[model samples]
Target: MAITIELDDAMASQLRSEAAARQMSLEEFGRRLLAEAMHRIQVSSNWRARNQRRVELIRKSTSAELTAAEQAELDDLQAELYERMETADQDLLDRIADLENTVMP
Candidate 1:
């Protein structure tokens, strides 16, 4: 897919300066930044799906009582999901700060 974005002259100049500082063209910089953001989103989404499945399984086994191993697995999944969600949230905030730094005076 191809997309076009229109940036004001001032913003463009700032982006150019940042690109030069990193020794990359603006296009390459944008692509790399966007790819990282997208990967984070994908990971978060996958974790959400896995978390939901674990929740469903726990619910299904609630009436019958889960074995120790099953309970341990669910606990592990919940912990991992929490960590992943926290990381994703932090990544988003960090990315926002980075973009703000680039555009803000």
Candidate 2:
């Protein structure tokens, strides 16, 4: 059976606008969302299991010292994550700006 998910008025308007921009029907757009949600669910499941293993490993590393190269790699990963977060923030700001001018409220 197909499921119905309710969105608040604002989110529904945003989805409709995005679908219009892509020249897609609301049903087609919703299918895309469902597909992405499935993928995300799988990823989160894997992440949680891996995170548990990581926590176990961290608990086992009481006297572990980070080598210079390891520290550099950690710094690089942090920088990349920060940059990705910044880009996401910028995209959110742009979307909010678009929403601000919508007459559908």
Candidate maximizing TM-score:
1
Model 1 whole-model lDDT (C-alpha atoms): 0.86
| Model 2 ranges off by over 4 Å | 6-9, 63-105
Worst 10-residue stretch by lDDT in candidate 2? 52-61
> 1-105, model 2: which lDDT tens digit per residue?
788889999999999999999999998998998899999899668756655654554454466866676556556545655775798899999899889879556
Which candidate has the top score in lDDT? Answer: 1
User: What is the lDDT, from 0 to 100, of the residue 95 in candidate 2?
Assistant: 91
What is the alpha-carbon lDDT for the whole of candidate 2?
Answer: 0.76
Model 1: how far residue 80 lies from native, Å = 0.7
Candidate 2: Cα lDDT at 21: 94
- The lDDT per prediction is 0.86, 0.76
